[model samples]
Target: MRIHLVDGTYELFRYHFSPGNRDREHGATLGVVHSMLQLVQDGATHLGVATDRVIESFRNDLWPGYKTADGVPPELMAQFPMVEEALAAAGFCVWPMVDHEADDALGAAARKAALDPSVEQVLICTPDKDLAQCVTGDGRIVQYDRRRQKLIDHHGVVTKFGVTPESIPDYLALVGDTTDGFPGLAGWGARSTATVLSHYHRLENIPDAVGQWEISVRGSSKLAATLAANRELALLFRRIATIDYTAPTFEHLDEMAWTGPTPKFPELMAKLGGAHLVERTENLRRHRDDDRPQ
Candidate 1:
């Protein structure tokens, strides 16, 4: 069937920042638990959630400007650990990343799950542009933005970023991700980077001189000069943008299939003031039990 891979870190950040979400200490955690239960109720069988236990990953060591837990609201940061445990109690496979970021785990899980012949589709549930690189042209793997209810396929990647999924890292490298805290080449902006990358595809593929470039770009001469002067720096940014697929994932697809909540789920929900979720989860589980072929 289909595999639903969620970016738990994004969900936590989204709900935590929403209006009235911070009033309760566990508001974000409770919000995420409700979302997961809703997913199961909506017919998701195989599902996985990846969360960043620590915001600072190995990328921080590679570049000093890389994203860290710094500046995140104290209430939001406090929910990171709680979200993972709550999702686990709700019977969802949670990949709590330590050394690697949650994006790496989502990429790894998407790639691995796509390999299973039995999997009809692998849906990575996140609007993060970085994860757009994981979408495949064949549509076997795609991204579902649960918040907006939007689906991004290979074509969507090209439409949004003006480059193919394969060139996303290169595009991000040249244009830079302010969210990830890296500045790209001085003159490079989204349109220029996308236009250049749409042709060259990768940093190394671009020629050193403007005259050497087969395609024309505005300020091609200056862009060429900037790229030539900072070749190694651009490459480093690309390396950081590329997802580390070696990040942890399940050994078997069956491990991702939801069975039911654990015994601790009720207690956990009670503590989080989400006891209503307990009834909803039980109803969903009971419905699944009745639907299963005996």
Candidate 2:
């Protein structure tokens, strides 16, 4: 069996900015549901979607520069709860994250699904860099970027980041993640960070003195000096970038199965002026039911 874990927050952002999607009464929320239903139409049976109920999380307390709702457009911010409601109404398992972000929830769900002996593959549906760490060997679990039509397995994670899956948080710590709003220490570019981290694998493992370095980076002296001076800050950024697998998202893959839309789904779709989605989901359900043989 295979499972699909979706980043509902990313989907919302994608559809909201997509061409000709802004004007509809509830376009962002409805478009997200339609797209997930497309995944169901394409043979995804067990699925879970994670959404950021409130943009700010406990990470805010850890770092003042952590991401928040302040930068997001008010119109886009407003659609969050509506997205959760619509997906839940459609019978998809929805994790509406509050203290933690959607990324951690999807990671936790992926971890849970991959552990089941009956599960063959777990596909995390997001293009976010933070998710690359969750990818595992032999395609047991992977990062599926639906928009790009790409599958990033463990090898892909290594090729992309020049480090193992275990090193991603360290890599992001050195390189800084503008998306998450955490700035890395000075003198740490992508190439330099990857080269150093590919060798050290973790922030604390790297030697503080440039003279003791085994591999030579472009500006090792300055990078080492900056890192030595602000080692605590670097570790903090790594902590912020790390995806928490123990996010209390799911325990069983069977719990994520899409049984069919809930009774209230049609009414919710009508309320959103997306009556067409009701017809689409109904047709898809009929096809699925017809295909199931006794």
Candidate 3:
């Protein structure tokens, strides 16, 4: 069996901003529910979605610039709870995180699910670069981009980022993630950071003195000086970038199984003005039953 961990916060934001989504109030929430049903239709047996109930997490205290809900449109922010309820009614495991962000929940779930020997694969379903750090080397854990129809394995991480999965936090710390709201150290761009991190594999391990470095990087002296000067700040950024795997996800792997929609699913869809989805959900349920063995 396989486990599919979704970044529900990302999905909500995606559907909300989509050009075709015209309904301001409930379009994104309903869209996410329908999308989860489609995942079931596409043969996802065990699915779990993680959502950011509160956009301001512990990271906000660590750095003043860390992302918060201040700029998100009230219309989109209001749907967080709505989508969580809709997915729960649709029989998908929903982890609505308050202190930890959705990324942490998904990462923790992926790590937990991958430990089950019965599970063949664990797919972290999101295009977020932060989740790339969660991908495992043996291919048991990977990242899936639903929009692009792409799979990113451990090798894919290296190919795209020029560093191993374990080095992503350090890489991001140096190169910075504008989306996550942290500015990495000065004199460290993608090429320089990736080149040095690919060799050192971590922030702490990188030599403070440029001359001690074995590999050649452009402007190595300035890069080393910048890193040495702000090493503590860089580490702080890394802490913010690293996903906290301790976030509680589930007690058992079977909890993630899709057992068809709950009784309230149709009513919730109706309330959202997605009556067509109600009928579609029933058809999908019947299809699942038919596929079952006697």
How high is the CA lDDT of each candidate model?
0.93, 0.90, 0.93
Each candidate's number of clashing pairs is 0, 0, 0
User: How many Å off is the CA of 141 in candidate 3?
Assistant: 0.3
Residue 56 displacement in candidate 3 (angstroms):
0.6
Candidate 1 on 1-294: residue-level lDDT in tens?
999999999999888888968555899999898898889988999999999999999999999999988899888888899999999998999999999999999999999999989999999999999999999999999999987899999999999999999999999899899999999889999999999998889999999999999997999999999999999999999999999999998999999989899999999988888898988888888999999999
In candidate 2, list every pair of residues with a backbone clash: none
What lDDT tens digits, residue by residue, belong to model 2 across residues 3-43?
99999999999899889795444899999999999999999
In model 3, where is the ten-residue run with the lowest total lDDT?
276-285
Model 2 CA deviation exceeding 4 Å by range: 22-25
- Per-prediction TM-score to the true structure, in the order listed: 0.98, 0.97, 0.99
**Considering lDDT, where higher is better, how would the candidates rank from best to worst?**
3, 1, 2
